[model samples]
Target chain A: MDEFIRIEHLNQRFDLSEPWLARMIYRRPKKFLDAVDDVSFGIERGKTYALVGESGSGKSTIARMAVGLLTPTGGRVLIDGQDLHDGSLSVAEQRRIRQRLQMVFQSPYASLNPRWRVGSILAEPLRVFRLVDGPQAEQARVHELLEQVGLSASDARRFPHEFSGGQRQRISIARALASKPDFIVCDEPTSALDVSVQAQVLNLLKQLQRDLGLTYLFITHDLAVVRVMAHRIGVLKSGKLVEEQATEKLIESPQSDYTRMLIRSAPRIHRAAS
Target chain B: MNGEKSAWQRFLASDFFYDFKRSPVTIVSFVIVVTLILMAILADLVAPTNPFDPGSLNLMNGFTPPMEPNAFTGETFLLGTDDQGRDLLSAIIYGLRVSLFVGLTAVILAMFIGVSLGLLAGYRGGWVDAVIMRIADIQVTFPSILIAVLIFGVARGLLPPDLRDELAITVLIVAIGLSEWVPFARTVRGTTMVEKEKEYVQAARLIGLGSSQIMVRHILPNVLSPVLVIATITLALAIIAEATLSFLGVGAPPTEPSLGTLIRIGQDFLFSGEWWILLFPAVTLLALALSVNLLGDWLRDTLNPRLK
Candidate 1:
């Protein structure tokens, strides 16, 4: 497989210790919580790698680190085999590396800037990266991006509040796509939407990936969601990647007890086999 | 192509505008504020006399009562004349201009200082937050009037004697401005702290925006609503503070008396037979302050998400 992203030995530790004054008063030692404990994974070009875990399992933490939103205490995130966190890389080099990757955040309501119109939100990355030449080109590209995300061109004139939850998520996806990224980190993009809307968003994401030939790091807690979206799966348990396998093999025959439990807990509806 | 709706038309269509229309008190307050502001802006044209100009003063016309002519001069005064024979109506109009000037200038100064400090403290966090917030905490303990007085005294002492008298209003503005900033800082810091945690800020960071850019562009707009509410209320407070300082004779100079100074001048005649001199300015001040406070209260309610 042609590896587009390689996250190796990623360790993220959060200092959960009391303040200096409190520590002195209480006579307690400093403490730290390992949010991501030496995790490793890779995603192939033009495929979805889903990281599934329960809340507090550090799935979102790893997703943030993969895109350099959160820095790892140890190890490296390699994009196209280049060390993303390497100190020797100049700022421009680092930015160039980041330009190839983007993230669609959880909670579309909280993700998009409330004050900005849809056009400005989608146009930001294109302007930031100098992807398009002028304002006219940027406007045209924004309209095209909106259409690609299953929204009308006129939707760009409206505010985020004017859109439904599902529509807002589509706008967020379009924003991520503005930079023409190869690898996108989708952090539970549809978790906040209704079940029916979730299916629509998942299908849209799948269609986008297929059409754009894009790779994705899909982070979700729902096994059912990953079932249709991901090509490969990595199950995380308390900041540790417990199991990694092809989606079909892992689900057909689970190795770990946690993975087995996750599968069993997902509600199933017996459908008429087509 | 069809003609587009104006920004004003859209603004009038918003929920905020609906709220404004529904509340009679807010509408009345808005009218009062606009009337007062217009009167202040057009003081020279609206006022019957230019009290600031020495030529406009008539020593012979001093002590004339409202709607009556002076005993010796036979000149009629509408709102009566002061000891210096300045037209009471013109004096109040001119005083309003100074009062509003000091209030608005101080508020702007305070907002700028406080909002910047708050953004730095909240975004940077750790030691910076501790330092700025601690200073704000200490300032919050003292009565703002006392702080204004202390700042006024220090500023007055630092300047050259010739410039001191010349720039007393400017010094008062600074003193009141400095004292009022703690509220702006505290409110903006609390708002900035919450805004920084939002995923939009994190997304901005992911896009490689600098801390300053994110703070100014992304976080600042989100936090400004509360700050605006604070500013409106603080404008009322700033006006009152300027009045207090001037009443103490440390505010606007006698040559250019503010509402506070006019009230102070009137207090002397309060015990004497001449009462209208003090009554008119006092009522104007009361109306101005009350209207502003009520408007601010309405804004606070409208902007609050919990209320919605």
Candidate 2:
């Protein structure tokens, strides 16, 4: 299968102790920690792949490494069937890759700088990547994005703090959209919002995904959100991937004990039967 | 994506400039500091007499009392004349000019050293950070003036006695600037340490930004607000340190009378009951320092997010 995003035997290890202290205390030359222990996964074009795990399961690490945020200790990540990152690339190549992939951070409000007005924040990627023609033309698109995200164009004048939590996440989503990226790594985009807002944001993500033909590597500990957004789910445990299957199969018939426990523990809300 | 229109408009409309106007003290001090800087920048056109011009001196006009008429010159001196027969008003303009020059040069030099070292230490974080921080700590133990003095003495000592006088001001500026740089470096290092962990920095790294670009573009802008506050306050401190050094006869030459040097020159006649000689320059220094320090305080309050 032609994967949109592919991770191959990726491993990340951090030096837990300083080199000097480790050497001096017991001649333990290097004190290392395996943050992501040989994790691998793939997401096909226009697909959503979710990594569901408890905290410290190395889910975030794997997600971060896949995007080339953290350098892997070993292995490779191929975005669009090209190893854009093995260690490092030329500046021009990196910029090209960044244009294709964007991120939505967990604390939606904190992710966008508070000092910046919403309109400018949204337009930043457009100007940085030179995606648009001029200021006047870019301003037109800014209004369009604000409208698309259910925000009035007048609201663009205000800062991030001025908006509600749900509105802020929408603004963040609009910002990610501004880059015209095909793949987005959403690191718990709705974790900081209320339950109502979470569903609203999740639904918006689904709509945008279908509309824009976007692929997502959605990272979250919340299994319910994973169920709603993910096409496939990979369960992680202690820096390792324990199971991988279709979202329906994983939810209905979880083989791994950790996955079963996670499914049991996830909060469910009552909905009218279709 | 259209950074220009957004940033400019926000800056114009923001409470930043309005906050400066809210306090009367800050307004007055800002005025004073701006006036002093203007005077220093435009010294020649406004000064009553050229203090540096040797042939213009009238020995008979020397020691004329403040606001009193000079007997031999028959000129009503506003602030009187110093023993060198230079008009006290003109001498002050000259003095203020020298003090400002030294202070500004030193601050710029210090900022250069501190900021570069700080960016390096913070971004590279190993033996470099340790060495820089330890050096800053060791320097901070002694008062900065002493460090300036020690550096000046060593630098001047290495030069021949004949070249020392000509090189004194440059040497003094270097000494004061190098000594004061530790605070800038320390503050920048602390800020760099915090900023390096931020996700945007990680994002930049992911996008394959070089370490230099990460430090310069991503981290520098975030760290600059604090550095600005520190720079403003340090400007006042740097000016004061320059004055103090000059007053001790180790600063500028006698031909170039900074406020501190003028005060030291006037001290001789203080006991002779020629009090105006000492009083006016002393008050000028007080006013200059107070105004600058006040402005620095206001800048610190205004720039800080916690206060806003």
- The residue-level lDDT of candidate 1 at B197 comes to 90
lDDT of 2 by residue, A100-148 (tens): 8877878764566555688877787787788899988899999999888
The CAPRI classification for model 1 reads as medium
- TM-scores for every predicted model: 0.96, 0.85
Per-residue lDDT of candidate 1, residues B98-123 (tens digit): 99999999999999999999999999
| Local distance difference test, each candidate | 0.92, 0.83
Q: Return the TM-score for chain B, candidate 1.
A: 0.96
Tens-digit lDDT string for candidate 2 (B145-201):
899989988998898998888888899889989988987898899888977876556
Best by DockQ: 1
lDDT of 2: 0.83
- Per residue, candidate 1 scores C-alpha lDDT tens digits across A151-270 of 999988988999999999999999999988899999999899999999999999999999999999999988888888999999999999999999888888789999988887876611
